[model samples]
Target: MAASVGRGAPAAGPEAGGALWAEVWALLPGTEEGLTLALSGEVDDCVRPLLRRARGLLYGAEGRPGEEAAAAALRRLGDVLRDYSWEKLNAGPWREISKAWRQVYTYGCLFGALAEVAAGRPLAPAVRLCDMGLLMGASVLDNVLARLVRVLQQHLPREQRRGAAGLAAESVRTEPRPAPAVRPEDALPRLRCPSLEHFRDNYLIPQKPVVLEGIMDHWPCMRKWSVDYFCQVAGCRTVPVELGTRYTDEEWSQKLMTVGDFISQYIVNENSMGYLAQHQLFDQIPELKEDISIPDYCCLGEGEEEHITINAWFGPEGTISPLHQDPQQNFLAQVFGRKYIRLYSPQDSENLYPHESQILHNTSQVDVEDPDLVKFPNFRKAAFQSCILMPGQVLFIPVKYWHYVRSLDVSFSVSFWWS
Candidate 1:
């Protein structure tokens, strides 16, 4: 949107200034009262000089500052502009205007303060002036953001709030049907395949989760990854903290002690969930070995793709795995420890209450062990599959099947998935 006000020109008259102020104020809602306050009596006098300076910067005619000085000024201006708004800084309708201001008027709000501070000039007014500038700038940006959101909403459909195209189409294509109840005894019978080709052709493509018993016996790390040996080899390179928090990324490289601390502190604790995307620990694992062939007992669907993710756990107490479904079939294998899992079928969508957006919400309404049905009325009717996974046991999770996992002991698991 173009500005209604003139650039770097003295207000033609109070009438002209009032017209411009009114035009700007009209962009925002619920601010008529504040606009009125701003226009009463001497308001133009207060806003004129700042507006002139801002206009000068906007036209690419202002003097430049050092890079560090410019960055500090921009950041300070951003903070000041965001503080007066109820929303996050630089979000919504006024984003473009706010961004433009940041670029052009990099040090407009702090030039005097910077000069005074550097020269030890002790200019008391400069401090107050800078603070006031920041507050007013925030107010201006807030109004702009509000307008931007309104404009966007006017042109877009509600479903476009967060792209629901793929998820919606998939849901429609698969008519809701009840899945067969999976029993604990049924878990052991399906642990192996006759050949890798057969497994890939049958199960992997279908996106089913399976548990395989004794597969770890083939892995070199099955014996070497034990907790005691890990503790001995890894000294005090990095200290461990509670789950759901971040730790030093350089710990393992800096000192071998960090690796043991990571396992003991993270793997053994129940109620721990480390966000895989945040720490980037998945990058540290070595690539799949060429000698290791895909197992037959495992299943894959035709023309499907696979994704592998590993999570390390070490707690005797189990972590809370919130109820969620994966897009692809999931195979969860316990490598060195044990965990208890509860599963729910996709047919239970109404009860699970999937998020409206394509991005899933990281929260669940029902608590697995002791659900408060009053809070989640549909939870009592939800169906589930349950099992305990030990080293070498793998569980096959069908596509869109909801499940919650809890570590029963210090354990490690790798999830292989395919679509």
Candidate 2:
């Protein structure tokens, strides 16, 4: 991902130079957080000395060295911070470990960003450095790197960015998925951008699922999001890709890789199943967030737009989400390709055979499409509604409703969850 700055870009100009020598130079000092923030044990011990060394670099104390000296020292500290956090990520619980480590990663990005600017590096690699911090850190350096990313992207030559997914999208084999062995009793009702009152009265109050049409045609994402677009916009940024048949499998695991690497190995070659599921990618890559607008229907819930949770679901055909239920209302909007979804009411919870484990209690143990009927006989009695959600459509899933999803084509869907 950290390919050379000259890899795919043209010559840099004066405006880019100002971003380097002026705005970015001013922002770097603010990232000197190690001196103020206190961590426990060996981690604190690691950060303290880095701060002491970097103090003179950012603070401009008496006899502080030139920009080259600052760049050299900061780059070394950045490398150590990144490696320290990386070791912790592989050693402990993801959620708990990522907390303090992300703060460490933030400093790494800060140091890396300052180093890139001081050295007058080209825009492409510099943009990737900013992206690493944005994607992997907590408490980002006051959105400074995000702003830098936007500025650098503007200067990148437009000719290199692909308008559509191109050959990668074209290469998807259109193998039709066979019919579900446990078919739905009925199809979910389809509506064309119904009014708030109508949707609330008919579906929301009753907590029923519905397939929505005419709502997503206006979203720029429908036309703009594709493999090539991601390759251009976020090719160098790392993302967590889920591997194996499904999450329920004993073999399931996650690996971090660049977006370009994920596309090449999974989306194009189809050698492995790598799903980038349930990620807040919009916050990480703000440029991509501009393509889609939140639906008016989300306003029906409290906090309206602010309360909504956005997640990106991108993977090749055959990725499966075993039966599960969420606690909030969801609008699953298909930006491209198709997905087969089936839903069961909360009243059928007993029949759905939810896992007994405390962590997986919301998820059903039974596979909806290929049920082991002899082992779970009650699953046969579970009534369900189904849909093959298409592009330019959104599926409304009520809270606590058991649902399963499978990709029918190379797919990209943005899900919005609200209480």
Candidate 3:
């Protein structure tokens, strides 16, 4: 009966088991020091016995512990595992919990391997348990850890949680020992609503980037598209949010949330940068489409004018769009904020070091602001034009021209794309 009980208990459903595993896994450590710290009373006492047994099983102990004690400890752990929800497990500092869990799983694997050697058995089932634990630990880090951190930041008081800016500051790479030399260049020219013939002859024909003023002054969005206005109009509408300071990082990802929640969490409160980028939000909210006009510049392209694609770009200050080129001519209209934009002509594509992958072919691998010039030495030769685009202005970006944009302040911009 004791053996049967030890071998089996009412198993939690997959969803519940996964949540429990994530919670426990989050409590483990990833390094030797973290493992030692976690085992030194950071985790629940009930978990200590199982961890001990895991160690013994892995290290080839003479025998299992007394049946009653082992069974009782197992029962206790099982109860906690089955009863706790993600909410309960995630109530504390998730980074600490995740580190602890990784440590526990690492030690558990070591213990399992040693026990297999000591027992002189064909294979011990406990080793499989250790393997599962290791996988769970990895899953916690790879999948849900960032989301958990975000949630913790949102709920906890400022003093309790490390600010997201501190985390971002840590990632800023120091300049290379000897910075690569780069040539200086002139700013992109600004023109005030030049005649369509002048625009076609001087800019479009030459395939040069230029900032056009007085183009967006007539758009309703220039006056009416404040954060509060968006919340009132599209608060409940769900939208895909880019969750990172920039898309260049591997840690960047996307999530879906109501526009109102996005405004409150990221725009108003100034949490970590969240972007409504490259999304055809106007298609989903036609009422919003009525507020802006596609610039006549798009019609200058060879493609049918009626087939223009519009994408919304809305984010807080410090948001960055890493150097990238589009397949179509782009008219980026600044509706309510200022943006620092740099443009590199397509002729410099060889120096840009575009990513090899087809999916990211349009995106440059090197960060424009702080390029690793040693690794991408040719980038030093890439001359560029730049401008600070203000509200009620439009920047005409010829198709395939490399552009990197950074918002100087809370900004909303729209891009009209055409062949």
Off by over 4 Å in 2: 1-23, 26-49, 52-55, 62-66, 83-101, 120-129, 152-185
Decoy 3 TM-score against native: 0.56
Q: After superposition, how far is residue 194 of candidate 2 from its true place, in Å?
A: 0.9
Model 1 segments beyond 4 Å from truth? 1-189, 194-209, 232-257, 263-316, 355-359
The global C-alpha lDDT for each of the candidates, from Candidate 1 onward, is 0.42, 0.73, 0.61
- Number of the predicted model whose TM-score against the real structure is largest: 2
For candidate 3, write residues 1-419 as lDDT tens digits.
22211112211233212333233334334332333323322555665666544433222231435433333334344334323322233567655555555444444433332233222222223323333333333332232322232222233343222222322322323222222232345677889989899999999898888889998888888778876567545554456789899997888998866565676667765657889885457755556888999887666778786688888998887899999998888899998767888899899999999999987999999888889999999999998988877788899999899999988777889999888
lDDT of 1 by residue, 270-312 (tens): 2434322211122222222221324434334443233343333
Query: Residue 54 error for model 3, in Å?
Result: 55
Kindly report which residue stretches of model 3 are placed more than 4 angstroms away from their true locations once superposed: 1-185
Could you tell me every candidate's TM-score relative to the true structure? 0.44, 0.82, 0.56
lDDT score, candidate 2: 0.73
* Local lDDT at 349 for model 2: 98
What TM-score number comes out for model 2? Answer: 0.82
| TM-score ranking, high to low | 2, 3, 1
lDDT of 1: 0.42
Candidate that beats the other on lDDT, 1 or 3, i.e. the better one: 3
